[model samples]
Target: MVVMGSGGHTTEMLRITKHLNKERYTPRVYIVSSTDTTTISRVLAGEDSSGTYTICKIPRSREVKQSYLTSIFTTALSTVSSFPVVLWHRPQLVLCNGPGVCIPICAVVFLAKALFLIDARIVFVESLCRVKSFSLTGKILMFFADKILVQWPDLCKVSKRADYIGRL
Candidate 1:
């Protein structure tokens, strides 16, 4: 499963999807925010928009400038809503960048993994903008995600688990 955020996050994921070998990643599942207006169109124009892909929508965990306290509730709501989608797909791997929606999806994946219901590995690709430090989502997911990929080598110093995979 691929979790995408708005604008740049979506663009970056789509770019990666384009280069992926379709045969190896057959019948992909794409998770997107219901509030996002552009992601669908962008995915339609993307190379991986073949009949094998399925797009799923979940509510955004937090909106821009929303209070962190309020986000807790919304994030919980998103996690609840994500259970059905995640279970139905039961994807073997989840690729997420720095999207707020990613938190719930990855959480569900982790929870299911803990319960031994499914085995899904998560890979978080830290956004290029986060050079020296990690984003809030990146920091939170550092311990949970199987691996975190960073663009800059210097960023690796911030976390021993993070790998500098160069610019994506």
Candidate 2:
């Protein structure tokens, strides 16, 4: 499964997936923000017509220009709604880069792991835009992610555990 935010986050995640071995990563699922129709369209247009993958839309944790109170409320609701989707899919690996949408999904995966419901390994790739430090999403997920990959070597200094795997 892949969690996509908007614009750059969605593009970067999709680009990384292109390199994945189709034989190994068959039947992939893309989790997108409900308002992000652009990504949904892009995925559908780019994917093979064989029905090997699909997209799942969920409410965004926070919308642009949204108030803090509303963001909090929406984030909570989004997280709750995502629980069942994550539980049902039970992906062996949950891959995400820096995206606000990833937080809630990763939280669901963490809870699932704690409850022994799923054994999904989270591989978080810090956004390529972050050359000096980790993004806010990356910082929060670092503690829980099974492996954190960074595109820039400088980011390796931010967290000893992070691997500088070069650009995706």
* Candidate whose TM-score is highest: 1
Count of backbone collisions within predicted model 1 = 0
- Candidate 2 — which pairs collide? none
lDDT of each: 0.91, 0.88
Candidate 1 residue spans exceeding 4 A from truth = none
Model 2 spans > 4 angstroms off: none
Q: Tens digits of per-residue lDDT for model 2 on 13-129? A: 889887898668877889999988798887776678878886898999988788878888998989998998898888889999988888899999998999999998999999999
**Tens digit of per-residue lDDT, candidate 1, span 48-161:** 435998889999999999999999999999999999999999989999999999999999999999999999899999998899999999999986799999999999999999
Report the CA-based lDDT of candidate 1 relative to the real structure.
Answer: 0.91
